[model samples]
Target: MIDFWLAAGLLLLVALSFLLIPVLRGRRAQLEEDRTALNVALYQERVAELQTQQQEGVLDAVQMDAGRAEAARELLADTEGVAAPRVSRLGKPLPLLAAILVPVLGLGLYLHFGASDKVELTREFAQAPQSMEEMTRRLERAVAAQPDSAEGLYFLGRTYMAQDRPADAAKIFERTVNLAGRQPELLGQWAQAQYFADGKKWSDKIQSLTDEALKADPKEVTSLGLLGIAAFEAERYQDAIDYWNRLLVQLPPDDNSRSALQGGITRATEKLQASGGKVAQAPAAKVAALLKVHVDLAAELKDKVKPGDSVFIFARATSGPPAPLAAKRLTVADLPVTVELGDADAMMPQLKLSNFPEVQLVARISRAGQPTAGEWVGRSQPLASSTTVPQRLIIDSPDK
Candidate 1:
């Protein structure tokens, strides 16, 4: 922020210099005009003396004529260096007043409309915070600087939850959902925060939030975990075990959270048996379709494209929503590499290649990181969702 202010001050000084230079030049011009007038007055006085001497017969006509010629020469020599005064329709006072107001008006306008707070926020975020409390403070300032930013609000809400400030987290998450739409993940986050803020008491609002999130994505991990926790607290051990078992199915094999969730299920099972309740075990997980694909850039565009550009490869349903079922991101430099798209890579739990009867493969190259709009694209005809053959796609055409 100090550096930014210094640079801004330097620019203001440069602008002031442009305004003051003309006024300073006008002063120098006035000095030249005064010097010319002084010289002319001296020449007039000398001529008056010459005329008096002639009138009194102290000098002859030829001597008077020589005196007049010498006086005229001396006057010409004295005034020759003076330049013509420039005409200024805007006189001295106006320029001086403008010079004063320029900086004042600039500072006023900048204070009213400039992004100084955002500038400071950007500089603050450039470095890592030494503590979580510091991080939360920075995020709070960032959200204040950009009140309409959903991403910043969401992160701030998460920070509040991390700090055990559930009441604040609930408010922030509700605002986030309002701005970003009630997506499953955001809804789940809001529900969890609200539940905790209400002293772990379940209410219609929290229930509605969780139900809505699950309705959109049944395997929303946060909602599942929160429901399991709520069920356990209510002494409904079987329900807790069931909710956790469902969550366990959605986690990746190598996920660190899987072990903890499994431990919770084990504890729930013991509690259920001790309470004389029957425990129904959850069914084994089903593996979704895994499609292998090879992506390549067109030979003609090899030199025209940047190597750092983003490339998105995905499979979308042929007869459903526009969102990709499973997607992967890579760079142009990673082209010709093979990638696997499966339920494991699902962008959402409810959307997977196996859930769609027919799917199309798409690969897009975008410099701006937008998946839908890009410079180049490649697509495959509708294929069976369970297709076992490896597919090859070349980005050989414009996106339009």
Candidate 2:
């Protein structure tokens, strides 16, 4: 901001120069005009002296004429190079007044419209914060500066949560949801924050938020973890185990949280067993089937599609529900690209590639960006889910 202000001041100086330079030049021109007039008066005085000498019979007519001509020559020499006096319609005061007002008006307009606060925020974020409190302060200022910025609000909410200010986090998350729409991840964050903000007591509002989030995305990790924690707190050991188990499946093997989640599941199982309840055995781990596919637009449909159109690729069970078992999304600009789909890409918790024995591949191009419905589509013949061969799918037929 210091540098920014310095640059702005320099520009203002440059602008002031444009206005002031002309007025200064006009003053210099006025001095030249005055000097020219002085020279004319001196010439006239010399001529009057010469005429007096001629009238006193000290000089003849020819001498008098020569003397007068010499006086005129001297006047011309003194006034040589003096330009014609220029008349300014604006006068002297107007330009000077303008020079004074230019900077003031410019600064006023800039303050009214410029993004100085945002610029300062950017500069502050460029360096690593010295402490968590300092970082939190900066995030708070950023959110204040851009109240409508969903990303800023989201980060502020997360920072508040980390600082154990759950009440503040809940409010910020609610603002984030309002600005960014009720996205699954945001809803999960909001629910978790609200749950903690309410003194760890469950409420219908938190339940609704979590349900909506999980319904939109069953693998929403935050909501799953929150539900598990709530169940464990309420002494519902079996329910806690179920939620934790679901969450465990979504975590990657290398994730640092996996061990902690496994520890939680073990604790819940032990609690359930202590209560004389029969614990369900964990399912056998199965290797997820990964299918590599190359998708492209059919040459015949090249003219029928736009570059910005959406492309959805998926595998569905050949004889079961129409819902995709695994799916990926792309754009028409990324056509002729290779993608891999597996259990990790399942749209729902119960639907997975490993659950199906045989499936068919599909590629759809939608101008409206709808995955289920599109303008054109293509499909592959039913094949075993475990097939390792890379299949090619081209979208050519009109969608029914």
Candidate 3:
């Protein structure tokens, strides 16, 4: 901000010069005109004195004429090299007033229309934010700057949820859904936020959102969790247990929320038993759209590659944008590892393994750790995301 202000001040100085420099030159010109007028006055006084002498017989006509000529020559010499006096229609104070108002008006217009807030936000984003509140403030400013940016609005909504401002989150998520086309994850988020913002009172709008989200993707984790909570609050213990159990299958093995979800299931089970309700057998886990791939390096390239070189393995929709839907990173030394790609490995909430029916598996060895370009690469033919058998990928060819 200081640097920006300094640059603006320099530009203001330049603008001021345009106004004040001409005024200064005009003052000098006025002074030159004054000197020329004084010289003429002096010459006139000398001629009058000579004429008086001639009339008194103290000087003859020829002497008076010669004196006048000498006076005229002196006057020419005194006024030599003086510029012609120019008439200024504008007064001195006009330019001065313009000089004063130019910068003031410029600054005012800039404050009203310029992107100073965006500049500050960009500067702040260049470094790590110190707190969640600070990050939230920056996000709010970003949303204000780019009102049509669905990605920005989505993040702001998530931040609002984290801050426990569910009402704000609900509004932001609604806008995000409207802009980004009501993706399953966004619909789920909107439903969760709206449910909480309504003071845990279920509404038809929330129900519609969750239903639409589940109808598109039954494994959408947010909507499942939200539904479980709503069922529990309604004292439908069996329903809560069923919803949570289904949600449990969608989560990755390392999900920290798994423990908390299991606790909820336990509580629901106990409540059902206390009410003399027979616990129904848990339903079979659905086959999720998880892909397991075995990655390896060609034996010929083993001698040419560094052990510490980065290896990026990802799955991307073959027909959509080239961005990875799910990704995993490792070093070249970790070749021959079998890894799973699923919704939990999604690079973003919207781009997930289950969202695309046909995806290709890719493996690359990038010394600089970039996923898009690398020295060696391997790609699989487009396959179903729900393929259960482990697939094989070998970095056997050059990236090109």
162, model 1: CA deviation in Å?
Answer: 1.0
Structural similarity to truth (TM-score) of each candidate: 0.76, 0.76, 0.66
Better of 1 and 3 by TM-score: 1
Candidate 1, superposed: residue stretches over 4 Å from native? 86-90, 252-256, 287-314, 317-323, 326-351, 355-400
Model 3: per-residue Cα lDDT over 117-204, one tens digit each = 8898889899999999999989999999999999999999999999999999999999998898878899999999999999999999
Residue 296 miss distance in model 1 (angstroms) = 19
Model 1 agreement with the true structure over 236-255: per-residue lDDT tens digits: 99889989988887888999
lDDT of all the models against the reference?
Answer: 0.91, 0.91, 0.91
Clashing pairs in 1: none
Model 2 lDDT, residue 44, Cα: 88
State, as a TM-score between 0 and 1, how close model 3 is to the true structure. 0.66
The per-prediction tally of clashing pairs is 0, 0, 0
| lDDT at residue 218 of model 1 (Cα atoms) | 65
